[model samples]
Target chain A: MVSTARITRQEAEDFLYEEARLLDERDFFPWLDLFTEDAIYWIPIEEHSDPTRATSILWDDAQLRALRVHQLAHERNFAQSPPSRTVHSVTNVQVSPGDADNEAKVRCNLVVYEVRSGDHRQLGLGDLRALPAKCLYVLRYEERWRIAHKKVVLINRHMPLINLSFLI
Target chain B: MATQQATTQRGYAELVEITDKTFRVSSRVYREQEVFEREIAEIFEKTWVYVGHDSEIAQPGDYKTAQIGRYPIILTRDKDGAVYALLNVCRHRANAICRENYGNSQNFRCPYHAWTYRNSGELIGVPDGGRYPEGFSTRGLSLIRVAKVDSYRGLIFASLSADVPELDEHLSPVKEHVDLWADRSIGGEHKVLHPHRYAYLGNWKFQCENGVDGYHPGIVHESAFSTFGEFGIGNFAARDLVKRGSISRGFPGGHSTLEGGARDGRGVGRGLPHRAEEYQARLREVYGDDRAQEIVSNRHTFIFPNVFLFDELVRIIQPIALEYTEVYSHPFWLHGVPDDFNTRRLYEGTRQLSTTGMVNPSDLEMFAANQTGLHARMEWLVLDRGMQREEVAPNGERMGNYSDEVPQRSLYRHWAQVMARTEAGR
Candidate 1:
């Protein structure tokens, strides 16, 4: 059984920073490898709502993510010709106590500023409350820390949005 | 109305000298505040503007709020299943009654003064009723109803002008096209799956022109087309076949349609390695041999002013300003088809063509460039393509071949007519 108390706040912050680095560096394959096979990436369309009923900007299973990654890598994607550059800032990392032996809840505030094709874009500001975003190597010692779900709730839900090509 | 008259006079005189051969429009049309105000009063206020679909307010007390030009209107379904379009402002102090975008509600209470209205838009409560005079009647104070609220094939539309033509009359030639869109649904009932809405920083007319222009598909979407080709899906060379054929342009009343199939529709679909068989089989099953063949292979048609009903989806254009436009796209399923088929249709339609879709970003880029180009030193942009080929038919439909500028010209013609009428009233 993994102890929620065992993972320090600094360790959680480091994991988030590394994850951000992988994304900013366009190391998509490695970034995708962080999620479990069954893990979901959801960006909800409504604030504090379930993704099933309410529409989402993005709701991708592993296969969809793979296809997106493939498209991003391809040279023919016109929108990505110049490629999108992003800097993700993660802060306010907080760990909540978990009920399961191997699970713990981690929350962080995120602000992603992106620029694509010479145009500056304000991607979004959101809070990610991911459960079981496990410690990378410590999963064997504590099964509870594996990520079960990662939910992103953006500040603007109803407003019109441009492409969400880059990960948030 | 007075301001509408003055603006119309100026617009009519300017449009009179313009003809089917004219390509560049006066920059004044895009920049004049008076013209914009007149359009709100004369066009948007008078005509029946599409609001939302019946499915949006399916249950009793379900409501959605939208804007009709500059006026805020609420669309609500009552207990009796009657849908109404009423002013969103309260009768007492004119404060907005509902702040939420959409919700299920029994009654709306104005936050300013607590004036309460029923789901059907009837004023039900006034705080401290005894304070009012005896003859003061809440009966006359019910939420002011929009002049007309009607639905065509489950698509709801409302108009603020009492004198505007009937809904069916206004739709006229375009009704047939709209029917084609809804005919796919079982029981001939089509509902919006809540639209995929997005905004573009360009004039709304640019969107209207983009959907009808077949010339740009191959050029602007070269990247997407090339990707499809790499996937063994579609070949840009196949589009060359249509280039040899004449562009067929038709105008039915104020509505206009542009029709031209790919050189070989079957060949293009065949080139797409993925889902080709599935799409073909579904088409054959739904349309049955000959009919399905025709349905699957046809050029796109635009119903003037604000709607574009493509073979697979419908895009409704709402103008936010001369420089900003909002588009709402909804996918329609062929009635009686398998649920899996509709799901695939929705998936393909949204992923490929929606605002945030695979092909849309490039299209948006083109629109942005066009918007920027309009600011260039050139007084006008050319629209003279196919001017020599325009032919007037006995039925009043102006016909032109595939590569013609006739469709854009047709829209300007309608614009001129509406603006002229407003001028005459002055």
Candidate 2:
């Protein structure tokens, strides 16, 4: 199910990289602009599990995503007082034929090395974490490619996960 | 002054000091390795620790692995359809038999020596049995079953002590609350979905104590509710119910609950999307309007040692070390409910409970700080809030206001009672 028309491999890789860069640099609102209003951001609880019947690590509509972004930017977010810093190394972008026209399923692998430091009250300090996931993106081309649905299947989905308050 | 007890051994009187008027817990209980070890021996081994829901191992040969105070155990259904909890340690060589977290297998073969055992706990193969003596029988070598196993409304529990009380007796105290939560469904049935688990550098008791802690929500999650209020996302009015009007109760055997009233039913009933409305109608049809109203009330339940039914999520807190805890959060889907309604439930469950969840990470930060800060000279942790307002019920449940410390007292008192005994009761 390879998408050979309308978009090229290099274009898709560039989009993924730019998205990762925005997240790494904490350019959230612009990153938020990258998704369509009806976008669904999902991090599945387990690989291949139905988010409708099963819980995902994150299942946010645009409304909840905005709330999340607002929390990260808000001053009183004690969970992010020191704030988590992450570098997303996104790779292996492959475009497949999606179920609809003007939309294609894009697949990529990501490893986000995150560190939470400067925890004076000892809330979250000296903590280094890793988030590895196989991300599936359904991109719809309007003026440019916008994320219609982004589903992240974490490798350590079943393991006890720590906070991912920061965007990845 | 803090008790002079050594950090390696905890005495009964040093850890907890419970009086009729007030209660104080030692910081050592949260920090000391000795108290943690004793807690594992007294609290986890003797109590009816929740293993997994019966629905998790529904089909024959289905299995899931869990831990009980460092003992790796597996809950599996055999071909005959009987549920069993067996220690995952291989009897032949003490190596782990089944390493996978969840799978369907007819037999578990120890990878070290290929000591194969039936999923039913029968030692079916020995790889080479002729090397042993004729009297060295395999009959006594089946995987050791936990001393007791039973279920209360699909919530499975196991005890390492054979003489521990019946599951019904152990669970009778919190059965009503559990029923209230479970009966919200159309069939009084629920299925645990795929779990998201992660470990924090904190004690398991932090999770236990936090389960029924209604007081910290407004203070700790200020940012979360700020946006909730800002976005008009949830029932923002009900967010302050814990601080203003609510009830925290303590039951026998260390079980406790924070009945934060019918105000914040967003996670359960309303203040949600269109799907919840239809779901509520279906629930009302099954349970009538009044009973449905009662069922959908938001509740925080801590079932003694291991389980916490927090809102729509079932969290299992496993203590791996003195300062490390692994928590597994499982969202439940009610049977016969509409797909959209369950979808909303799953969405709300993850938004608050997952690793990247806004609410949980805040609580985890406090717990981590609490664990880290206990090494200070200020050793006594005060749990004296709302102590004088206790109203005891006929069933021995002590009730207090929303911000009351009744749960902490109840939990620590029971912990003291359990640790006071040197051996598991017969």
Candidate 3:
């Protein structure tokens, strides 16, 4: 029920920044609304490995995303008992034209600094981890820009990773 | 410092104390640097440690790098299709020969000085050969090979010690459990996908003890069970399996199993329903009804020292240090099952067991917490949950209730026996 206007580079950048803000703020329920109904939030184990054929760090559909939110909210989910305090810094956003005027492919560099806040000083919790990744977002305009797909390719994808119980 | 008594063989044997009523492990076993080093020597280096699966190196010249205790190894298939586990160090110097995790190559040329070795650990080429002394034979210069290499249903294991028992003998205690898992494919092969590797701040045996220790799922994994239950999403550790009668069985070796009392095994038909049905029917055709039913029943089996085979994935525990451990979780794909089914399996497996899975992170948290808590002056950690109710089966397995420390007791018994071995005993 809206115009099929072309999305600009500024609009894509703003959308990505807002998304990053929501994630860093831990406003998960509101952030979930930014995605399309058939959204695919993926963090692939390997950049080139087929998600259908290979294992992924995370491949959350709407149902899974909701389930994860529920899990995080549960009182006994000790993995996130203290909940990570994260600051996501997004930069170098480049919006390229998509197949349609209402769609665009937005690429950006993301660095998230996360620390498990509270009394635990364990290796995974007390330590401040800086996760760097290359993020690609497929945006579609339906009155406003909504993410159809979000892929975060971590730099240390093949290495031994620690507690990634939080949204990255 | 009193626990520093572990410098001797008898001291290692004393780490576990078992009476008719109770079983306890020394806290020093988790907190000591010396105990960890001795374990690498007396246990992992001496036992048949899993290296790689046969499916990973299906073709000739296929190769993968692995580690057994502290030693780096290369697992390769030669042109003749013979598999070998070779030390990855160069013959000339101690430089590593293969750096890549896995690939296919007939020969590996060292980055330093270009010394080369064939896939079967034969010295094929060496640069500047003329500089060597006269009659400096290359016979003994080949990559130092492991003493024994063997596989059971595609799971390869290697031993560094020549005095150890044969791999078959070592694996005999849990072969039936292994067969039930492997035979699920009907072709008797499992294709291991790329691993989801994660590290934790805890002793390696924590992973070993955690895998078969059935009591924790009801307590530690409360959120996961509750969440999955509310959504009706099936997982390996379901609540009903707890309410029903899942049992814990421990073998003579350190191996143990968490046998689900459920008929269809939890999470068996949750995803890819049609494919699951097809897989079941096909398994029944080859193995008959009773065997097929046994195959479908849940069995989370753990082999001694390193590997665990759950319904969804194969978990390899790699000990790094006294308080650090690395785990590799590889989702299993049935050989003849359609790719879609395997994909669903991967998704479900990783969903629960991956680095960021709903279940694994909490376990990691507990392991780290346990490691930190062991710094207390308290000396013993009890492993006596269902000891009174434990019964010995005809097959030699000690069976206990679903939430029992029987498996942990089994692990410690074997651990003490292995650690207590002396040069005279060998």
Candidate 4:
């Protein structure tokens, strides 16, 4: 049985806002640290399907994620110049129960508006799965919740996405 | 200003009869709404436009939505793995039935009303079927199917006109090129790596022109070539080394192919260094020496209207508007080639020509700028480049040098023929 202490909606919203801030600020290293070591970051090429068999815009495990971060910081990446600026808004936060070990799943809707090299793009209505949208970081007294998985399903998943240089 | 105005007026007249000798198309073709509408009806509707590959929707119940000219189409694979292209609008209200881009579903339920359709496009369920007044039969309410759906070696294409020529007849001379890529995939099964699709602010013709325009490599892509040259990497400056006389240019119907030495005969070293040995090995394994050598060292071919089949992958150009075009760059695996070989091809294609590629950005920049420039002035743009060297072929068609505007001229000549025929019929 899991502990019944549920996180408030306000706390979940704040956590999402902070995550978006980190991404918008281009603080990648810290932002990456938010994910657990075994976490999967996915952006499906097709909507409502398994990413394993089909092609996906992004199906990054830790290694792939690291490689993307490395490439973004690399000098030879021509598209990175005039780096993309983004503002992510998380709304409609809802918490649901997870499968195992006192894990609580949180789902929220997200809209990320990004601008790069004079092109403005809107990525709307994505689902984010976090153990707890808010981070407690408990030292000793209680166990803290952190993100175990973050899957973003965009409304226009099949649309030809331009260079996704910046994190959403 | 008066002379310029007169020139513009004359240019519009001149554009209506573009020939094989002309290189620059008249701005009217790209801007005139009348021409755009005619093209949609006559050319797109009459021709076999590539929709998607067979591998995209492999299993039963898998479907993808695509646009053909102005009409939305749903390409789905049935339980038996047969592909079908159906009009996306619901039979009831003409509302799009499958709103999502792609998914696996036993049936498609329209969000507007509860009207449902099976993946095979059958009218499966209708909410409150009894509510229909009297003679409404669910049996006759199926989705409108495209006139013809045909596959050429796994690449599927559909036409709105039933009177259009058969797929093989329309493909005509370009069938060899299609086979070259598709045959490499085992049993004619080629899946797209979910191409890097993006829209460029240019006419679709620009992309077709760019596909066979060998002359632009040394100029428009100077930055990319120069970067490679500076790094002392591949023979980026080998343009002069390629045997100009060895370049082969031919037209099969509206389609054209240009096979020549890359970078002036600097040889088959333009691709990624890591995959060089594997590619050569695979080539040798498949076609032995001579054919593999030809495939590796040659330039690209343009399958008229909008398909570009290069060494590694194919790009299908979908015209969205007069000033905007969407290109889907799909990478395919060559049959019998190692998985590593396909990966290398995918990597090279993605890094160089995909939406986010280094060279593609520059190409898009030039295309956008060209579109902007065309709309800038009222003066006639010259399509007369290399007209002096055009030679009349035995078939009455004209031909030009490898770097000449022969192909573009051929394309527009066909375009005019098709448009004129449609107008005459009307």
Query: TM-score: which candidate is best?
Result: 3
- Candidate 3 lDDT, tens digit per residue, B190-258? 888888999998899999988887778867888887888788876545556777778888899889998
Native-referenced Cα lDDT, model 2: 0.82
Assess candidate 1 and give its lDDT: 0.66
For candidate 1, write residues B306-383 as lDDT tens digits: 777765566788878876777877666555545555555555555557644667766665666566666553445566
lDDT of 4 at A129: 19
Task: For residue B295, give model 2's deviation from the true position in Å.
Answer: 1.0
Provide the lowest-lDDT 10-residue window in model 4 chain B.
Answer: B263-272
* Model 1 / residue B234 / CA error / Å: 6.2
- Lowest summed lDDT across 10 adjacent residues in model 4 chain A is found at A132-141
Interface RMSD, candidate 3?
1.1
Candidate 2: tens digits of C-alpha lDDT, residues B1-426: 235758434566557887777688878788778778888987888778989997889899999999988789999999888989999989987999999988999999999998889998989888778999888888989999999988888889999888788989888898888888788666657888767777777888998998788778888888888888898776644356765467899987889998767543454734455666777777778878877766777788889998988667788989999888888888887777677667777777677778778788888888888877876746788998988889888877899987788888889878877877763342
DockQ of candidate 4 is 0.12
Better of 2 and 4 by DockQ: 2
lDDT, candidates in the order shown:
0.66, 0.82, 0.85, 0.65
| TM-score, candidate number 4 | 0.72
Docking class of 2: medium
Better of 3 and 4 by lDDT: 3
What is the DockQ for all candidates, taken in turn? 0.22, 0.69, 0.78, 0.12
Candidate 2 wrong stretches, greater than 4 Å = A1-5, A95-101, A120-123, B7-10, B237-239, B242-244, B263-267, B271-278, B281-289, B423-426
Instruction: Output the TM-score of candidate 3.
Output: 0.96
Query: CA shift at B306, candidate 2, in angstroms?
Result: 1.0
Query: Taking candidate 2, what TM-score does its chain B reach relative to the real chain B?
Result: 0.95
